[model samples]
Target: MSTPYAPPAGYGDISFVELVPLALRFLGLGLKLVFLALSYPFSSTKFSLKRVLWRQFVRAICPPSSIRQLQFVCPATGVLYQKYMRSLPNKPPVISENIGDGISLHWMGPKTNKKVMYYLHGGGFVLPAVDGHFYMLDWWRNEAKKRHGIDFSIAVLEYSTYLIDCTSSCQLSKARMIGLINFAPWPTQLVQVAAGLAHLLKEGYDPANITVVGDSVGGHEVIFLLAHLIHGHPAADVLNLEKPLAGAAALSPWLCFGTETTSWKQHGHSDVMPLGALNKWSGWFIKSRTRTDDSYYFEPALAPAEWWGGLEKVAKNVLMAGGASEGMFDDIVTTEKAMEKGAGKQVKLEIFGQEGANHNEALVEFACGDAPGSTNYRMLEWLKEVYA
Candidate 1:
């Protein structure tokens, strides 16, 4: 197996070196806000005034080039963990552990819980988990126990972010060396995810009791993991299962990496994340791979329906949710249908889309301090049924 990418110590901490870029990013955001205020009324997209402004802000902050340049400003997993701990109503015991290869597993509830939700967060694979993700996970755990009497622990996988573009190994100028560094990419994350599942199994948690939950790129990771389980990654360690996982919830999963799609043309302005940014992020992810035909691993939307065969061997219950306004809405719908078709009618799979909502709406609402929305309610009901 290849060595995992271990981030430099204090990589998350902001330094004087990052100040200039950070300041410039915020300044650009301020200017973008001014433009939004001036153009909201006359915007081409018929979204609400608030949504139009949000789309602009998301576009400004999420440009792959900008994120790669000012990556330190995005808080790391450790910082997110601390913030999540503080937000909890009842303090649980310290439950974080390093699970080899720079990956860490953080538990929101006690490990003694019988059921587990293994969570992978999404920030286009370049960003780290945020305060909102933790809030949403905590809410799920709390609500599950309160409403359905299901006591499940959440194991948040603190995987490495794809920060650098170090596909080239040749000697480079000092400028190029400083600007481009590959922290973790494609197969590295797949291996890390396999390690996480291996850890859970080693700790005596049955595969049938664990549900894999992911959002955005994190949701993409769930799909990647499922595909890996079926077809296996050449670089990643083998992850064998005695039984199917309890369930998997992929919300607003980035299924397709390309920018050309009907939804992209229609919801280009309605969604928060721009397709241009997604394309750039996807480039950073797959640049290091040697093979040319590995697109199936990164862009599952391109895979044939037959490629999803045997998905039932990975997870018993699958929930695929996306926002109707999201650019990848069609891809999500198509992928779900393909999964059902490939896995046959016997497979338990479902798809959800909410009108007027944009990618990962449930987590975004939790981040904004609102109660769980309709999608969250639906997911909660799904969980109750899965655990029952």
Candidate 2:
């Protein structure tokens, strides 16, 4: 008999700590609405109340920083660790081996020439590691084995971050360095991931059998990988291969930086994210990476409309997913719009709309059946169609 599914504990219950962030987000949105209302008459564009309300709603539900904390802290390092980290009662048929440099390969089913999935974890470009995502990872692996009936290998890339003092430089005050390294101007981590994928491709894995998936900031990494693969190295000579991937998937991706999206503007209240908080985090990120200016890697959305032109022909299989009820809906929408406008028919978008589902909830739904409508199941089905 199949084991009864239990929702991860700590998160199942609401707490003051969680409420604090939510309250702060609401407060910020309230402030922004007030300011926009007062400045609308004198403003150039008529203040979009719908946009403002929508953004505010998203802020109240899917605060970016809060989502980050849940992934890195609550699941990886908090009291709920047991619920999320415990090995499945029934171990998956696949074998998982950890390759060094924060990468791991989980091979499922009998060894055969089949598609490989490169899964990247997202934590606002900061927290969480492979272990934190084991539950969802294992679930996907098993599902792939059962549905595809072909061996599947997952290359989990461990990318460097500026927030964790893991690097030799333990200096936490280096906000500029942290920002540059953590935000990563060139998607250096994605290049490394591509390197792993290339290794598999060279080792008998077909180029057409590779699918790259990432959540949150990792979702942004998918675009970075495609952009780099198509356009060549923008910042460094990392990977020289020009092979096209089978497909790419991003969940609740943070595509733009400092744009007036739902998250950036705090729903409609400029005060939600607080210029002070933004400056503080931005400064910290920049200092951690030891970068003086962050415009190069930090702002991909601001790139010219023709930036994705090179990828038009090469990137034929692209899957972008986000929750309509989340603050990142605008990010996903805008990104899809950009791709549609730039790449024309090259990109394929699959947006999963879960009413009342937040950002973290969207991810949880991808790996676990937390959100309504069995979101993870739907996503896996989509992967099956793409890879099959």
Best by lDDT: 1
Candidate 2 lDDT, 341-386, residue by residue in tens: 6766656655665554455444543333343245566667776777
Q: How does residue 129 of candidate 1 score in lDDT?
A: 79
**Per-model tally of clashing residue pairs:** 0, 28
Judged by lDDT against the true structure, how good is candidate 2? Answer: 0.53
Shift of residue 195 alpha carbon in model 1, Å: 1.4
* Cα-based lDDT for every prediction: 0.75, 0.53
lDDT of 1 by residue, 109-145 (tens): 8888889989988877667777888878877878888
- Give RMSD to native, each candidate: 4.5, 10.3
